[model samples]
Target: MGLKYIEPIKSIVLLLLVLLSITFTLSIWTYTPRLDPIEQSPTVDISIGQRKNVKEIIKPYKFMIKNDEFMRGTTEQLDIDQIVNEMATWKITQLLRNPVEMNKKQMNEFFRQQNQFTLYFQGDVPLSVYDEILEIEEVNIPQFSFDRLVVKWNPKDISFEVHFLNRASGIHYYGRVTPIDTMKSYRSLVVGSEAYKNYAEVLQPDGTYLAVSNESLTIQKLTYFQEELSPTRFRDALFNDPNAVRRSQVDATHEEFGDDHASMIVDTDLKMLNFVHPAAETSESIKPSELLIDVIDSINEHGGWTNTYRFSHINPSYRYVKFQLFTEGYPVHSNAKETTEIAQFYGDDRVFRYIRPYYMLDDPLSEEVELPSGVSVANALMNSDQLDFGTVEEISVGYMMRHDPEQRVYVMEPSWFYLVKGNKNWKQYTPEQDGGEQYGLE
Candidate 1:
């Protein structure tokens, strides 16, 4: 009897275990992971006809009447009937999921899925008028489509300025303004030249009518408008001739080198004379006196003779004559080459005379030489007091001899020296003129 009872209990327990196993299997087939309260639930598969109603889907969430502030607002005091009527008028039906509730990963997936339904509105629009409509208290959304979301609102508040751009073939359509009635329903139609036969209708706010086609037009039209405008001085100058001179007339006095003047003078007495030699090549044999004579002769021929002075015994015993050589008649060449050519021509014939000594005249002598108004010459030698008589007496004599190779005529320059007079004080005399008269020994 004990064995019979134990067998029946064992059979009953085995049967219960079998029933439990079947229940577990059925639960496994139907089970879905529970989502965190903050996390979006996983999407469940459903046939097209069995999709959840839009109202039922949004019923749990609070409907926000979009105020100026996005997330915060006063609780809508309207009754259900009033709310439904307002929503219907605005054509609003569905609520978009709040972006704040989504985590990074879920938000990314949602965006990926929702990007297909999002609408993009892009164009040039004035900001002032659009701000008024965007301040509305509430708006409604209506039926939705899977491929794209269609929303409608009254766009009465939108304002626009239209512009046209000429193209090679057809016209383009461009809308400029924010839609006050509908946010996502309105979109900027990017009409290309290939798609439209004429884009002229899109150019202005109220001009012409545009035609739409399905030919897959790829034409792109661009219109540029400047808000703040200014005129450039260069452009104004280029377009208009405001009495501007084509060639300016410079004053004769303002011209450079036009009134330049210079003169030659003997360095010994700082007197204005026609002749002056370069003190650099001076020698005892080529005395300052003789150099003075030669320079004076060259200046006379050059036509710039302003004044001349004779040397007198009253002024120190040295017999020196002074004169000014004017640059008024001096030859002016166009360039260095021309000047050099002229110099070479005079140099070959021993006619070129150095004008250094003349330019070295002191202030008193320079003043003596008459010059044109507003013209002056520098006295370089007056500042350098050292007389440049040659070092070697023989070289000086040789240079004087070579001064006129063609003529073969040699002349000794005049000089002054003291001679002892019968054991008394020395007296000076000109070697050429006085010979030895004033000198007692001679």
Candidate 2:
């Protein structure tokens, strides 16, 4: 009986040892320790400049007020802002394409009518985009744009009428101003036109109008302290995957950065940057309104408005847009071609090409120089042999940006510019270029 019991106990103990060994082996293969969380690459938002609103970036640079007696125009910032603010309060309705066919003569007559205020923009601003600042009634708004807005007070109807005019394409839109009270503000501006300087509305040979001061006008020449921005900030802000970008020194004054899909070249001498994203290229044409809005949003997303820039030009056919730096209510043009403006070409709903100065204006120098009058400017333009008077579209005052390397500043010399048809380029007029009388005050 003792020998039988011993054999059974030994077999049971052996089976238990085999099961424990198998369990330990499985644990070695499948066990996981309590490890720490894996670290990730930190995402930091980089902003090299300030963001701006549509109203701030897209403002009227010039305006004209016409009454029964005479017409007055000004490029003063305050005056333009006042009118813009006043117009923003009113409700606009009944916007439609003007059905009446009018030739240049009839159009000029309508524009010169009494109790009229016209706001002129540098570029063809989309009516829908401007509706952000303007109070437009919700309706089937036409897809059109305007370079000027003509607001007229109808004393008979006791209301106001707004006309949107695209000087380039002759597309006209008319809207009725509402609340009935907005006319008072419009009237006040028109009635007070006498206090403002007188402007002579000269009809261009091309059937457009150019407003010039009757007498010699004076403007200020400004100087600004400029600061170069860091390339790393732009690389981080503009690139979708900044960490993957590789930087290489192209030369002493040029640096290039790129990844798999995009490239950016920094010209240290010019303090300008040109970025291209080939993947975003699209052959399809984008609507002017959408293109303009997208350009603003893209810059705002990265806070890329480095200086006081205003909407200067846009060619929808090529999906190209430009924002030029402005100072003291006047546009600024650089001696360096395409350097003083933030230019963009859109594709595939993304930024295809971006070229802009990587420098910001720090402060204005105390010294102020007086500029030549609009009268003299107009005279010079008309008398210039280099200019085709018939092809001349418009003339305006602007500043020529001359960079000073040693002092590290920009001297903004006030000058006159004449826009020509066909190419639509604003050519600068100087005593040397135009072979005209000296424009600067002695």
Candidate 3:
């Protein structure tokens, strides 16, 4: 309470303030905040099966060459691959749509030129996506889709020109091959393909020409053993959270898997799966190039390339796509059920629906049955009372899948397949059923 005590009191107060300041500074330097952890998407990384490259799924099923000397073609995988590999080496540029009107007659003339060859794919392949398969130089590739790539050149011409044709939409794209020397190699490959069969250029109602065999030839019928695949693999791969999913057996033949957002149905008897994801559905239209790429990636994510399935069809308007089962270089169609196709319907950027078979074809039986030639088959189809020739878009040799209940095996009988315009169904044409005579070119 005196002057002597005042100095000591002030000193004590200053020391306490300094200690408080030091405490505040230390607390500010090492402060730890309490915040919630970041959440991750459940389906970010899902793998239930083997993945596949884009080239494996998107490949040509037929290759045809027409020149002044011969008209021949082949469905052999090896032959097709050889030509595709050669084309892949060439740099293609100036991919633009040919605005010139080309009718069926003009197109046929183009095909029957001095030297030309065509590679036919099963679906409308966007040129941008096909950049993965072909060596394309143009970075600003336009939005164009093609089912056929026709390479044509004349003996006098220095360069070979490529035409991408969409048979369904009647759209044609033109591109050029650089370094004219590529033509010599391409021509040689075409010349050396002796196994290619003789074909007749038959014009169809759709302004497309089907190269049917002109002579009588035989095709072997294949019978394969059957193996069923597990549906659980798809469930685990598709569902956002497999652990939170519920399974329900509708009957002996039908089973279902679902969560709060999506559901998948399994047709056990038919060995098919149908997956639907409503939450991923969107009404916005997606580019064909983007759609095709996304669907392939989605299937590859779950190793969905179970069998030798090739891209068969695509409808960008409906956002529907299909991959058909192929055997011995021929597409296989099921008469009993839609068991030979892997189909997808897109909703926005995601898959809205996926329908595919769950069976894998084993090795074929040794005994082979013979099939009539494409000419005879075409004749039979032309004479069929049930089928109108006008509706026939194209004709080819394909295997008709028939299941033998007693033996528990599936038989792939090589037969003539005719594509209908309205439905695009590849109906199996039997000679006896059609009441048409088999007559090859004399």
Question: Pick by lDDT: which candidate is best?
Answer: 2
TM-scores, each model vs. reference: 0.13, 0.86, 0.86
How does each model score on lDDT?
A: 0.22, 0.80, 0.77
lDDT of 1 by residue, 84-103 (tens): 22223332112332333334
Runs with alpha carbons beyond 4 Å of true place in candidate 3: 2-46, 179-184, 203-208, 215-220, 436-442
Tens-digit per-residue lDDT, 1-442, candidate 2 = 8997998999999999999999999999999999899999796867678888999989998888776778788887888888788788888888878776567667766776787778888888988889989889957567788888998876566578889987656678888887546557645566555667788866566666667766555777677786878988999998989899999999999999999999999999889899999988877877888899999999998999888899978888888989978888888876534377899998786899999888878768745555566667777677777666777667787888888888878888877777776654566778675665433210
Q: Tens digits of per-residue lDDT for model 3 on 380-403?
A: 676677666767767777777887
Model 2 segments beyond 4 Å from truth? 1-43, 100-103, 156-158, 203-207, 336-338, 432-442
Which run of 10 residues does model 1 get worst, by summed lDDT?
A: 392-401
How do the candidates rank by TM-score, highest first? 3, 2, 1
Model 2: how far residue 48 lies from native, Å? 1.9
Rank candidates, lDDT, best first: 2, 3, 1
Q: In candidate 3, residue 379 scores what lDDT?
A: 72
Candidates 2 and 3 compared: the better one by lDDT is 2
Clashes of 2: 1
Model 2 per-residue lDDT at 91: 86
